[model samples]
Target: MLSESSRPIIESTLQTIAERINDITVIFYRKMFEYHPELMDGMFSRADQAEGIQPRALAGSVPVFASYILANPDSYPDEMLARIAHKHASLGVTADQYEIVYKYLFAAIAENLGDACTPEIAEAWTEVYWLMADVLVKIEKGLYDGQKNDVIHSNFKLVSRKEAGTSVLDMIFEPADSTVMSDAVAGQYVTVIVKTEDGLRQPRQYTLLPSAQNQRRIAVKQNEDGEVSPMLHKLEVGDIIEISNPYGDVVLGGYSDQDSQPLYLFSAGIGIVPMVAFLAELKKNHSKRSVVAVHADSSSEAWPLREEYLKLVAELDDAKAISFLKDGEGDFQGEVRVESLDMPRLASVYMCGPLSYMQSVRSALVQQGIPGRNIQYEIFGPDQWILRATRRSMRGNRV
Candidate 1:
């Protein structure tokens, strides 16, 4: 909740703040990192930071949160907060970090705003920041408490490693020591902290693929430009890596209770990660619910876990798998043709991929009579989907 004084102050200056929010956030991260160099060690992703994605994403989230609390006053945006809390929990972001962020972020605001940042303005925005932070802290605490281990990173030693596909490594791990807890629910992701060539510990999140009870499996796609994934690609069967307990709110196969309704799982490229986990469970349970799984990739050989997902779908009596590729043939060729996709009756749709692709799929689903409310999407990076959609909607309406 926002204070009465802060809500108006926020609403009045939101456009200005939003216009320069990226600058404010970039400045905030720079100052915070300069003062607290240790943050660069593990907490923040050096790659995302270098690319300016994380800063810009946080820039969007803060103002959006303020806007929501100001407008609603009673109920906050549950979906947005859930996404944030899950990422925070996965990255082991602590409550105290919010204070550190506040100190620098406000300083950046005050500096950036110059003469316009009055005492009243400062006080009002401060209230908004704390209110948003308080809600996030509470939600993140709940996520941390719900996990098998209360601690952030536990040592997980690699038990198996295989080349799942081109540029993909399937790594499985068990608790390194008796003190470490190992448990992962399907559709969750574990953050792997790896020591880069420069000895910098970079953290990257990978979806928890299906594996044994005492072990965790994750498929790492080597991003040539990324720091962590390339390093993970080189790991041997016996190597150890620091992994977080699986934490994600997008529990796979959690859409509807009724079996008569169809389930649509859509993915592009490596986005098939979580969808595969859901398909594994559905197969294990011998679920008779109609399932339509669509995957798009550069080519069939390039699809990570393609065989695994297809095998799972094959085992399910009421399920079918479709693949789309740019390199030639499949159920649909060229690009993912959401326009040609058959709309199952009242299908519960789950999609994961690049935000733009997800947006396209969402729009197609809407045009095909699938309710927007029925679609669920999970993104690998920061929770800026809310802002991205807002920008897209604004652009769409401009013409």
Candidate 2:
């Protein structure tokens, strides 16, 4: 909890801080990268940086955390903090790195705040920063300890590579060393680090599909101008790359794999990754739970792991798969109309995909008498949609 002295100051200046947080974040990144060129090499995504996704996420998260801590005198944002920690752990973020971040971040705050800033305000914000950082450090450490091996960078040899769909490569990998693979739960992801042709190692997180303990499968969507995925596509069966331990907490069936309630898995574009992962887990257990797998893509051919998902969904005892495509062939034509689904009562909904798509689906679900708390969403990148949805709901405003 923030000190009593800091509360009024934060409340008084929160609007200004929120208004200028973006500038602070952007400047923080630019200056941080300017000073620490090494972070740009592999630890950070140059693409995300250039696109300003990272900055916006940082900007959004800071004020959100502050507001939450300020409003709730005792509680912390566990889900948000866990997601952030998992993402950092995927990138091999260390506790010491927080020092580097704090230094540049404080400078950015001070520079942006200017005349409004005072030592007391700075000290209070600094306390908030460290509080968040300290918690993340502990969470990340726990995650690292739970893994089979503590190796942040381990070699995974490509066992096979095949086309899953248009512009998608289904790459299978096995341990290139003696390290044993830990059985990662469904909906978990691993960070694949590829050494680009430019001699920079870049890491990108991909969700795991159900596979043997000794093997891992990840479908990579080719980016025409991607720094890493394109290079990864060129590698053959015998080639090797670095992969992190499977880590992500968006799990299904951890406690009640046998639950008979309806489990709605929704996806858009590559958001199908986690859906497939969950489906694989359910299938492996021969789950009798009712499943509705909904997906949307540009076309049938453009859908990654379409055949695999179709087969798996069919294999389930009580599961129906639906697809909507703008230019689809055979079945699954036109855009998705969420209101049209035969709504299930007391359903456990999980969603991933484009922010707009999830937001629309979630809104539709909530209107159809589905509890807002029942809907769970996972973002492929920094989480923006959830916060927006949550805030809108909390304020009792129409979206």
Candidate 3:
């Protein structure tokens, strides 16, 4: 535990470290592509990287992590951790890869900070990185250990594939061996690993759609631009996919145990996956908690789980669905446009989807004076926001 006397200094040191990390992340990617040409294969989106979004997001995340540690240690922002873990887990990033990232990160820091990179500062930052890496390594190990001990990886066999709707697939994974499939919380996800022709394994995640509890299944919306998604879409029945045990933090347990509070779930496109899962669990448990589900897509056709969401809504008196787009058609109902949504009675607002959509929703919520604690979000990739937010808070305190 960090002592009260050491808290301020540690916080200050962490702030500096966050600044340095922002520098390191930018340079690390440049060096990675230069030295590790093979790693670019399926590991990064070239177009997105070229657009400078993912890189900038990663650079910003270091500071957000520092902020979370100093400002909100109790919760530790599960949303941020879940997002990064999902991305890393999807790629099957190992403890070894974390070390690689740390190496490149520190090296770039030393290079960028130059005269400012005093030995003392470098050591302090390295200690912080190691501490963080150790924690992440342990968490990741727990996931791996669960898969190994429970043999969740061996249980799933692809039984069939059907076109749920344009590019979306309903994949059934039946137990091949006697391994009992672990019952997953509806909104949790599983890491699906596919062995490529080059013998390198690439992993992706899909939202486990609600189906018969006895059989494990998932709904995957294939991304043509994505390497893993396209390959996943191509798999035929009887094919095998290596899946890790279900893992995710975006769940609905908070309301189930407590008195019913007005819960609002906001999702866009594929972000609806976890929400669907949560609704399923709530229905199965027969919890009468009030939930308002609002989903937005580019069009009605792009919405991933339209039928299932409707079915769940029909069964539950407290559940409702609000669609923002219909087959490329834009908003019409005008009942709190995705950009305009802000409700005070909402006990918890869980958001998932693209960065822009999440950002827009977050901004609108903030404008409505919704406390950060009341807003939970799930992002799509590595966390740079966590570090950035922390640094901003630190700067405010200093001022």
The digit string of per-residue lDDT tens for model 3 on 54-154 reads 67665555446545666654445455555666555545557887776767777887888788777766665565566566666666666656553445345
Model 1 clash pairs are none
Write down the TM-score for model 2: 0.94
Per-structure clash totals for the candidates:
0, 0, 15
Model 1: ten consecutive residues of lowest lDDT: 390-399
The global C-alpha lDDT for each of the candidates, from Candidate 1 onward, is 0.81, 0.82, 0.66
Segments of candidate 3 deviating more than 4 angstroms: 1-23, 26-63, 67-98, 141-155, 176-180, 196-199, 326-342, 385-399
lDDT-based ranking: 2, 1, 3
Which stretches of model 2 miss by more than 4 angstroms? 254-260, 328-332, 389-399
Cα lDDT of model 1 by residue, 72-120, tens digit: 6677767777787888888889989999999999999999999999998
What would the TM-scores of all predictions be? 0.94, 0.94, 0.79
Q: What clash count does candidate 2 reach?
A: 0
